[model samples]
Target chain A: MSPPNALDSARAFVVDDEEAVRESIALLLRSVGIASRCFADARTFMADYHPDDPGCLVLDVRMPRMSGLELQDELNRRGWTLPLIFITGHGDVSMAVEAMQAGAFDFLQKPFKDDDLIRRVQKALEHDRAQRQQRRGLTELQHRYDSLTPREREIAERLVAGESNKVVAIDLGLSERTIELHRAHVMEKMVARGLAQLVQMILQLRGSSRGDR
Target chain B: MSIPPLAPDENPLPAPPAESARTNFASEDRLSALLDAAVDPIVLIDSAGRILRFSRAAERLFGYGSDEVLGRNVKLLMPQAYAQDHDQYIHRYQQTGTPRIIGIGREVTAQRKDGSTFPIDLSVGEFRSGAEQGFVGILRDISERKRQEQELLRSTAELRLIFDNAPTAMSITDIRGHILDANHACQVLLGYQRDDLLQRRYTDLTVDEDRAALVADFLSLNAVDDSFSREVRFRTPDGGVLYALLYAGVVCDIEQRSLLMIVGLIDRSALFAATREADELRDRLVHAGRLGMLGEMVSGIAHEVNQPLTAIANYANAGRRLLQNGLTDAAELVSILDKIGSQADRAGQVIRSLRSLTRKREQLRERLDCNALIEDVSRLMELDLRANGLRLQLKLSPALPPVHGDAVQIQQVVLNLIRNAAEAMQERRGDEFVRVTSSARARAVVEICVSDSGPGLSAEVEDRLFEPFLTTKAEGMGLGLSICKSIVSAHGGELLYRRGERGGAEFVLRLPTATE
Candidate 1:
């Protein structure tokens, strides 16, 4: 694999009610070749941003208008799955424990190094990119399956079940000549070149069912 | 032969009876006279329904002369109600041939000629002469005998009633020591039933370990001629043992035989249980109070130590910076030592505070308004309340009279109550509050009420509440309330409990107000 690029190559959002702290964080991200949008609080971030892009969030733990935890909650409510990093001036161990437990990427105490901040931001961006790519791959597989005809679906089930052309045609009351044609269509549409490969694909799909729940 | 005139004591008295026969008749008459002269009342009535004779004894008993009643109806000596029936009774007996009352002795009522009735025993004998039949009835007055019998019956009944209903347990046993009877109180006190105790013997009621020793004591008592008495435990049916003061005695019946042993029982079960509870409570309270005092002292130590350490850190940081810049010298070292001395003074102040708190002393009483003392403690804890995000409501009644008590001791109680209230509400969210109220109870009484908005005391804790150091807190030593109870009781009053308005705990302290 090639080396990953800076966070600015992707997208980033900084949400804090303190304009000074917000601008300083934005500047810190820029100094490291990362680009970002800034919001004064959670409300402005909600109205302005699109979540589908691969990005990381920089948030302040305490804010007068919509705190960082509340913003995390609102983003979850809206199904905007961004990796969140929190910043606090007076960080207690329990509060830190709680924020980490809630899936926060990292927490940076005040007066932290600009280098340290950028390192975590880059890491969070990469995680976001990987998750988005996986979801895209799933969607492409879903689209391919949706294009199949009813007759093609029956052929595919039997193929996954390790049935031969002769047995499948006998079960469906079709001739072997027509069965061979549908068999080629099942492999090509499912992007599986062999019986082993097709079975592996079905197994992968079945194991990931819990992620839906 | 038809007309021979015999001379007196001549012609052999027609070959008459011998002289010895006449002598025998005279002796029989003398014996009859002796019977008549006896002190006991005697009367003879013939079967012909006639009073044949009555002795001087009978005269004293019936108040009548022998001639007056001789050959007269004996029924005349009876009451008017019995006289008319007497003749019919005699006539019916002579016809039935079954001899209704003849030859039988029985007790019945007799009436004197003066109209007084007394009990008597009458025995009858039957005589027959061809067709003439007769009954000889002998009468003995028995008024004294009846009185003696009644006295004996009353004593027996009264003793039985006492055994059955005595508030203290009691039992009776035979000479062999087996229980013959037990009272209801004995059943409740020993936790046994009448069936369980009967024939079981005194040794069985005692705990097995003590049975042999108790039997030996009883034997010793019999030998020395003293009653056997001791305090012992009798096992109960429900498996709880009871404490009792027991007493046993050797008693003899009319035949001079050891027929019964009287056992008296006085239960001390409640007193013993209460004493045990008191001891356990005192131990727990002391332990908990010591732990709590240790915790407070540690916190104070931390605060005191932290200030000096902070100063040391500042000094070190400053000295390092100065030395790095080449500005430190011997003069700067002198100032550092002075700073250390000042920090030592601050530490000293902390030790004194701890010393004052942990110092023990006999409580000294004074006159002061309990309401005012509570307010002072509350103000002292104001910062702690704010730090924990709690609010306070003071509803002290106006002009609360001064109470006689140890001010410092009562102050300690108030502080502990407030601190407990604060701790109970620590984990809960939303408007947490503690309210203190005071009221003028009566002319000589004052009540101080403390209530909190935390979860209330559980029912289990409430029951054994005043018993020393029982506590619901995980880290608590459980001594706070017990000490509070001690302090309140010392003031000649009571500490009462109730549920707070916000579904929590409420404690009220009632103290005797100081005289004006």
Candidate 2:
């Protein structure tokens, strides 16, 4: 049995120049109850691919016209976060290393055991699902934060920095009663259950924004 | 010179006293003395064919004494054949008054006293002592001159035999290249009869392209010892071309004057063909060896094979999973099994192609699409190029004419050039590319150019780029380009190199299109 959250709509995308290889990978994924699509080359896969799709890409590293690494670069440039699983053939260690450095989920040498490929694909799908959820959560949090009044946002930033309610009210040169009211509004808008939860959400937003570059 | 007056007993004919008185004894004695003193052996015969007077030199020449044959028939001095006809000839001459030997000198065979035969010059004169009309025949021994003439004739006959029977084709031509004489070999080699060949000028048989040079060589044969030899092409009457080594020399007289041009031709057509065939075989072997030695090619082939194997493995494992889980119907399982089978076949196909590529085989030529060849080579090199972080761009012209050449050999040449281009750009960073282009050139020629985006060749390396044993790579035998060049040339094509527009080395291979 697969994980409920990861496999509900998870699909495997197999891209290889070889028709048999591409078809067989799709077949293997299908046998494992995972839905799949096959593409004869990276360019075709890119043409039909959507950034919002919940899937893991099983890519052959040595396709003609456009190789797997090049496709990875294109995906990165478009700011798509689809997880990539590279299938390297013989003597493709250097390419595999390069793919890994470019944020690939994993790589498998050709003729690898079916279980190894299935396991990697499942893991890549789980990772992709988790990443999408995190991104959605961050977007929602930003929307909540965007809805805040400017004065309330300033008070929330200081409180999340571990300043006391009294200290935050002084730094803003406002009444403690005024700061307390603004904190309540901040927590309500961000949908935080408590002060600790509010602190974690704001920190996560700051870290993710820095990583966006 | 002294005269020994013949005693009465030794005289062949006794002079009558009345005739002797009419001619005086002093005059007779002086005439006898003059005849005896002559260096040439002479004998006097009468009209009856009997000997009348014998000089002393004649005695030493014929080995006879006058005392022994004072009245013997002159037939005794002739060979059997001449002796039998002498008497009749004399009688015929006397009756008809036809001067056979009279006032005419002839060479006739004479015999010595013992039995040896020798040649003589004979002349007869009619003399009258009284009422008798007698013929006085004078003869001279000419054996030494005759022996010299026979010697000259024998040597000339031997020289003629050697010249006519020599194995090499030979001809004697005037300075204008007009053939005066051609030997049997020359006639056979040219596919012409001896008389027909003799009627042709040496330039006529020469291939039209070579005729001017041959004429120039002939005109320069002014010195008595002038001679030259070179490889030339000759056209036969049947329109076949013959490769030959031609040697021309001037034949001179003893006075060192140029007389005739003696030309010799050794047919080298078969030898030239054999050499070309051997060169082709050698190139094929080297090509196979180079393919084997190419590390990048081996890795690429391995990757190609692995792709299929991986597919097969995936299918086999998938089939097992479906069967175990009962997750597929029989039809679906069968389809998966079929996929597995074809994948194995795919892997086997890759191996078979690799085996054929590296196998030492006879050079086989057929009409081939150059675009197809370039595409095949590009497929083979895909992984290698990717591994090096390089891109290959193919700009193949569609509807290209087919070129005639060995498929394997041509593929090898294309692969070598691509590999060389890849290596040249291997060290360069950023946007490295190797471009392969195929297009039809003028005159029914197909051109394939392999160029890279790396540094072009150095001047020193470019000078000897195609020379064997010249290598920039440490592991290279430096025979790749040379062998490729030979293979292209053997196919009646050309391989050229130049700096590409991208400022990298470019090799252009042009092969003639196959004519239907």
Candidate 3:
């Protein structure tokens, strides 16, 4: 069999204490040519984890030592951004609400159809990839914004806050021409080719910084 | 009947309890020849107690010659201790004419020529030898008769000892059923003193229901030579009734008259009650065992059925995928169909085994192959063994004979044993084995031993292993082994267990081969 292509390398990691469950889920993924790794418990999964690896996590909710929610918190603490889908034997309402509120991508109860699990894993992998790209763009934007002079940086913040160039100049008691020139310098340093693109970059940076917080 | 050698004017007199006196001793020389021919040793003594003659028999008995004893005091043949009394008796008899030494019998010790003293019966008679008054005493050696009587006494005492110490309680009752004698065991068995029993009739000790029977047996003894025995309820001292075996026969005197009836009793209350209780417990266990087995079957039902269900689903799903891909081969389709069909059938078989478990049927004794019975049970428990990470080793002897038992009950026993062995290793993992071995042991018994590799039971649990509801497991009702033991014993077998060589539990069940 040929190895998985790079685009399909965003593997799904499955953690469950039940050997049969892990094997079945992995077999289902393999049937559709999706790569997957399996671990019997959270500790073993954590021990073998590659922080920079591109994957999604499929975990059981009610594990013995380390529950799925606890593992989610552990992943967040380590600053890893893998999206997770939970599998629960007891799919009670309160548990579902708690998992979803804690940012679980999705959860499916046991004896679920193979299609349901495969779809969730694919979606989680897609979400994680998109988040990775967003973070990279945010980091580049923050670097360019850091290069601005103090006055230019101040003007740039006002621009990102939705203040027009004239309004920002009036509030800072500067001449409209100086505000325009500073805006021009700000757009150059941040590499925004258009006003709309500059606004979108600043918004993306805000969302990513909020997520980091 | 009269004493020998009477005087001329005397009348005949009767001899005493030691009777049968000899006569015809009229002349000295004739009497001398007569005395010599007599079987009893005889010595002739005169009125002064001097010996006149010693016959040849007397000489032979006293180890002396007649010349040596003649003209001497007859006391010379008497023991020295008796000499003074003998002389005085003779003096008194001559003075009073009371005839103490004549026409009367006395027992005295006679001295031999060697000075050894032996008992003899001496009788004296008054005789006249040409107007001289003299006493002719006839002496007899009675040692042989005394020895024979002593031997008879000793034998009677020995028989009495055997009767008194015998385990079978024995008593002798008169023809009227009144107790004449009772041995020690009989007294203890009836819980009565010898005097108490003697005061009451033998029928009084028996319950009212059995009184007539006992009396009939006693009354019929006179007509029967051999003993007649029957079981009767006899009253104890504390008012409780005990079952006893009574054997009665008549003991008769030599004149063919009934003397007493001998009755023998044995206490069978304890033995009889225990046997009854055991039979009842066996029936109850058979019921309880059915319930216990049902619980185990229900508990493992999912796992047992899930395996085949999983396989069936996999096969069906695989075939569906193949068809969806438009890549189905006829051979592959047929193979997949076969697997799905058989797996469903396998699940159905488990359900049928459950039906067998639930059937509360009576014990139907069937001659069954022991090895095959084991195979059926293990097949039912295949999933359970796998789920608990246990490996089963079956070492059934090929030449095992068929055993007579209730197949379902024996199946319950095997199921309990295998399930217990599997549960014992629930906490352990790989390399653990649950081994079942069947062999034809000595005495036509087939034995099955279930041994495991898990840790054996604790010391406290080992002590009370088969006690109901005393279990080591957290969820255990603990009647499993107890019910198994009852089932085995009810089939005329035994259930036994011990610590295994590898520190696990080993349970051995032995059942007898079919008698037919």
Candidate 4:
């Protein structure tokens, strides 16, 4: 049985020049209880698409005014986050390779089974939601972490480095009791349950810095 | 006798003792007159190397007065380059007295007063007179004879050069049609050793079927004209047939009556190949054009069909899920819908791929990765490869950079190369392999090598492999490699071939990389 909250039931966009492909993909999305918008081509889709909405895009690889890949590049350039599923007629493996390398969610050849396409779209949507949530959590973490005073940051860094209150106090040229109060504030601000959790959060923040770049 | 009677001043009789002196004076006068009247330039030189007497002709020839030349050494008349050798030559001649370049007659260069040298025929005579011994040298200028000899040598050398290197095949035969001379080209063209063809009759070399016709043609031409021109086939020593246009003519050679035939080969094999290639390319272009037109016509049908296919699939899936939940009402409809949906989509996909392959837009030239293109085309042709029971071995270098080319077009070239290699090895007795490999070469070039275990190209066809529409296959149009060459050249690359290490024909394509 299909899950009720399967991302196939999420909002979606169908972008294509062919009328039948556009209408059919929209119908398919509706059958899965997903709200979808249809446009004739990339230009029409771009003109009407709302950045605030969280949805996946079903784009034709080849289009008249703008190609689907070029649209993906432009969206990326504008920092707009959306999962992309390419539907190709002449699906060369090279193009598929390139699309995946460029971070496309999935690529489906023409005349693909509706279930296969729907399943891929559903997977892409799920992935997109998880990424969005991760980004939100990261942003919230960064905001809270950035609000810490320099002294509190020093204490947090020292605690994460496995230094005791006495070592951190000596390193920062502060009192041991003052270091203890700052460590408590670091844990509270980062929403950690304990010193171990706080250290884990600090390590996670450092690890994510490498991945984001 | 009557003038002797005059007795005043002319006939005054002297005393008897003075009579001998008068006779001596008369003899000296006679000798001088004889030397002056000679036609050859004569010079009389004493043993001390002094010019005692020089005739009027000698004075004119040596550019000097008799008085000035009388006491000078002969060295004064020789130019500086010849002067150093004159003394040695004179000494040698004097010592040997064997007439090395003197005595009876000899040809040598003599220099006049102005320092210009001319060929001269000289004869030196040795004689002993009463109180001194002297040499009488007779000289004749022969500049014109020397010029004629030089001109003859130059023309002979030029003729020999032409005879050796002429591109047309030439054979010299005797009056009886026996081959007497075969140039290098003629030997190679007829596939015969020089010794084998020598003394062989021309009729023996002609194809047996055409010998009668050739003989008739030759005789008819000889009857009307001195030369005969006819197209005939010649049998090679190795049993191969070669087409040649033979032009034979009768000529009287110095030693024998001979016939010289200059054969010009029209080389129609390459031409016929090119023509076939052009025809095939035209067909392919027409096929592509028709495909494009057909695509436009069928796209509407394709869309209409795709819609129902998608609907059927969706309905079938929904029914399948519903039946999994223990609902049997929609189960029968599901299998029927699945079958229809699968077939419709399959048809739609075939149409889609066909249209895309032969789309209206011409292939655009750009920098592309050959490995990527090969992978794409191979995937598209996977079904064909499998159906043919062929295996494709790809050895692509991972770090291969992009080569300057049209990706789609080069993919077509690679496809043709691989397909031809596979087809060539279709019925090979042993293990068959169609190996495709790519490597970077010369720092800025990429090479794609395609080799197969097919029967290698014949020496004959290998030379004209890229000529259009020449195929060994029964159903081939033969435009594959010709179009491939055009594509390669359009991208500033070269396609080449040879017999593979594994006993098959190998084709290698070299393309310039983007940086190159």
Candidate 5:
């Protein structure tokens, strides 16, 4: 097989104690040109999992030793951000709700249709991709934001808080031209094309940080 | 009996008829002493039945002094009825010169001085005292002996009553197996008359297969030892068979020698008929229980069978996708086909188990591995448990002793209980699992334990779980545990339950282990 590329490498790790079920899910994913790996149980999947893997997890909610819910909690404690798609049984509505509330991407009941499960897995993978891209973007923003001097950083915070350059000059007891110069430097260091762009980037950082919390 | 003669040779008088006057008088005094010393009361009466003489013994016996009764009429010593008849009899005897009771003894009731009457042995004799013809009487009280004789008669009558009316058949047979005497019940049991039974031998009443055993049992009792009990079929006169339990032993005589074999027969034909009827009813109940369980598990079973269908469809879909894309790895297509075939087989297996549960059939015993049976039921219940969010775990011991039982009935019991556990935990939230395990309890017993991780049972529920019409759930009819217990008990096993370690209900069934 050829080496995995950026898009091809994105996989769905299907973990279920039931062999036939897990294998059927993997095959379903493969039918849609999505690469997938199957694990007999949560423990084996945990041993093989990497935080940087570009994928989602299709996990059976209930298992003998370590259940999928428990594995989800463990992965969360280890700071892994892979989107989780759970496979629950018929009478497991409450468990599904709990899993979703715990930040799982979604859940599918057993004996679910092939397309149903495939669609859920696809959505979960898309969510995982979006999250990874956002994390990268946030890291780059943090690097640039950390490069600003204290005066420029203060002016940038005021501008993003809806204070114009003249208002920031009044609040900080500086000349309007000086405040404008500091705001220009802040915009250049933070890599924003305009005043609105700078404010929107800061808003995204706040939103992302709140999501982690 | 002969009466005592008054003028006999032992009168204590002088030997010679012509004795000296003084000696004759002395002889008379000695004769009086001898008469006074007699244990029997003696009295002399005239021809008119007048009292003439009374001895000291008579005074003590009559409760009167000799002086007080010297001239009293002899009628005073008899009851009113006898007193009236006595004087007439004595007058007739004197006139006719025909002695009545002169030398004969008879038992008569005499009145004492205090008016109490007692039975006595009475004898009277005639004697000539200086041309005065009179009578001497002697009497002995015999009340105690008479009362004892009456008691013996009453006891014999009571025995006859019991022997005639007892429900159980009974007979007395000689050591050689001859029927000596039989009660009415025995006649009814054998459908024959008492005379007919007496004419036949004990073995003649027994079935052909048991006749020899009957003779052997008779001879066995010849040792004059303990009684023996046996179940045998007796052949009645009309040729019908009578099932009976016989308790027989030797009846010894007063000399401590074996005289006869007394046999008691308990007729059990009615009980046999009733048991067969009950067995038929139980079989119907077992079928009904299976149907009920199927009703409860229908949706889950459908889902289980539907799984394989779903898998087969998915495999076909994937195979189609591959072929349309011109990526036909022929080997991959073949493998997918094989998987589809296996899935069909899996669904077929589920249907087969369902058919067994639904069919009405007779019970049969077979030697089976307990582990294999556990695995079979576990598979049957897997989809149902999955639907209810309950996990199924099987911990079957590999080398467990084989059990001889009806496979379908046993499977019904296991599946019913597991489903019951599912319903019990339906309301609870958490990791719910039903774990079934088989192990050896002892050399003679094997136990199957079904435990669940739901709310444990309360004492009242545990006590009533096996009772008909008892249920903790609104939809439950409560026949599951009752039928399970019946099936287990019919196999000589016990079904019991208790609170488990994981705060859930645990049911344990113990069946007698059979040797392979």
Candidate 6:
């Protein structure tokens, strides 16, 4: 039931108030050669969970004391981007809609086929890995952008805005040759092999700084 | 025979020289006419017991003519029993000059012309005319007065018999609250002896709380036929309380003056207790019916059953996957099989509990942990809360003392409160939550509070929140809170509503501890 490109270190975290449901989901994941951890309630899961973990969370939508959705809200408040897959016994349409609107990766009704769950878990895991990779790439781009000189950063911003070297030089009251030299350094430091890639990196960094993950 | 003078004097007063004999003759004629006009029957007898004269009234009363008994013995007018003793008595009295019937009037039996006996009043006096001594007896018939006296005696005895044998407790009291007479049943009902009860006042037997009202009712009875009735509690000699319906009325004389108050008590303690029990049973039935009709409860039960089934399916499918993967771990396979079996049992348990809840079974009182009861309800309500976009937070105390009540009924109360909280928060937009807390309170009570983070109750609703048929919801019957209150009160507990600290409604249910 494992996806073709399933990562070796990726795991599945199962949280449910029902012991039988929590353990069985973990067992199903184990059968597919996927390592899994289980929690009896949302609180225990929250205590040991980290957003950096390369995994997807399998959560029971209804739990005593603190429900799965509340835990998801807490995670969102903390700015953690852990992928969530909600499982509900009632298959409540309104609950599914709410969970989806709250940025849930997927919602599955209880008594779902093993293949269906396995497929969703794999897809969620893939999404989590991809998000983490993009985050890492952005971090690397931020570091390289920090390495640029002040003049190169100014030219980089103008270049990403579709400004020509001649216009940028005139606007900054500098020579076109000086602006061209700064632009070349900006591209090299940003690790963009082309103008399109450099512009994309600059835009990505701008979007992240505006809290648009 | 010479006619005896009508006068009783031994010697007539010497006539005035100027008066004539003719004047005396005229006065004598007038006196003879006056004797016949008397209303009472009058008869005159001589010293030898012979009748000397029978007046016109005497002739009619004895059923005889005056001429027939002019010289007959007076014994003819007497019954045989008195006649035999009368002749000897007159002879002895004449010889000894001692008066038996001479100057004293006495009642004696008399015989008439037809030989029927009647009662009469008789008096005799001696008179002499020139040494010819004679006794004159005057007689008056009194049969009518005797008949009326006998009639009064019989009816009084009948009234006494009826009062003593009546089933209702009855007592007659003076206007001052003093008991004048008490019947047999009154003694038994009050748990007192007849003599002891008579000494007690009506106010003495009445319970302290009802004493004032009873006194007021008694004092207000001033007119003939005035009456009042009410349910009252009385304290018996053995320190037991009795409930009774008291009916009291004033007894009056012919002159319309109130004489006494007659009280009747009908025992109603058993009836009152039965009615209370019936009310409790009806409340329980209504609660069960409400639970059956709740849509959220049905969905919650469905979700509960699905949980274990889902777990069983997951285990089964995982085992199949293992087998298909060519796994050889026998221990793991056995564990998976065991888990699937237990999960199936879990689902069965949920269904069984649900059946017990919805079934209209006799309410059974048993010791129950409040925390456990809350947890059971929380399990059933979790799915419903989620479906309504609400969250539930439980903070059950770990060591709460057990409460004694019907388990199903108490759980139903808790479920109702949770559902109400959820419904209250339906109009809320964000961060909706219902919190349930259980803890041990002072005075050996277990407290469970269900509060919501929704709009608090309005002033109008808070006043009559537990009244039946008072509803804020469009489709609600409004019996939920009222039934819950009744159920709790039946179990010797209290259900109270107050504004929660979170600016929402909070319901506190406090049950007496089982040990208490």
Clashing pairs in 4: B277-B468, B277-B469
Candidate 2 CAPRI grade? acceptable
- For model 5, how does the per-residue alpha-carbon lDDT over A1-213 read when each residue is reduced to its tens digit? 223355546899988876777787777677777789999899999899888888999998888799989999998889898989988774677899999999999888766877787788778877888888888899899788889998888888888888877888898999999998888788888889999999888888778779779
Q: Write the per-residue lDDT of candidate 6 for residues B371-412, one digit (tens) a residue.
A: 887887786678779988899999999989899988877888
Segments of candidate 6 deviating more than 4 angstroms: A1-7, A90-98, B1-209, B216-305, B326-331, B345-516
Report the error of model 1 at residue B248, Å. Answer: 2.7
- In model 4, chain B matches the true chain B with a TM-score of 0.41
Docking class of 4: incorrect
lDDT, candidate 1, at A1: 15
**Best-matching candidate per lDDT:** 2
Q: Can you rank all candidates by lDDT, best first?
A: 2, 6, 5, 3, 1, 4
Q: Local distance difference test, per candidate?
A: 0.70, 0.80, 0.75, 0.69, 0.77, 0.79
Whole-model alpha-carbon lDDT for candidate 2: 0.80
Candidate 1: residue A78 Cα off by (Å): 91
Lowest summed lDDT window (length 10), candidate 1 chain B: B1-10
DockQ of each: 0.01, 0.35, 0.03, 0.06, 0.18, 0.32
How much is the lDDT of residue B396 in candidate 2?
99
TM-score of chain A of 5: 0.84
| Least well predicted 10-residue stretch by lDDT in candidate 3 chain A | A88-97
- Model 5 C-alpha lDDT per residue in residues B1-516, reported as the tens digit of each score: 222222221122322221232133436778678788898878876555556667888899889886776656677877787777665565556556565566877878888899998888888887765444556788888888878888888888889889889887998877776888889998898788998888568677788999888778777776565578888898887879999888888778557766777888888898888988788767756655564554566545655665676678778777886687666699999998999899989988976765555344436778767777777677667877898788999888877888888877777778777878888788868888999999988767889999998888888887777885477764444546766787788888999998898789999988888766
Q: What TM-score would each prediction reach against the true structure?
A: 0.40, 0.42, 0.42, 0.41, 0.48, 0.43
Query: Compared with the true structure, what per-residue lDDT tens digits does model 3 show for residues A1-213?
Result: 233476656788989876655655665565555678999899999999988788899888878799888899898788787888887652244675788888888987654666677678778877887877766777788999779899998888788778998898899999999999999998999999977888887777777778768
DockQ of 2: 0.35
Single out the weakest 10-residue window by summed lDDT for candidate 5 chain B: B9-18
Off by over 4 Å in 3: A1-213, B1-31, B34-39, B94-102, B128-131, B283-287, B290-293, B296-516
Error of 3 at B76 (Å): 0.9
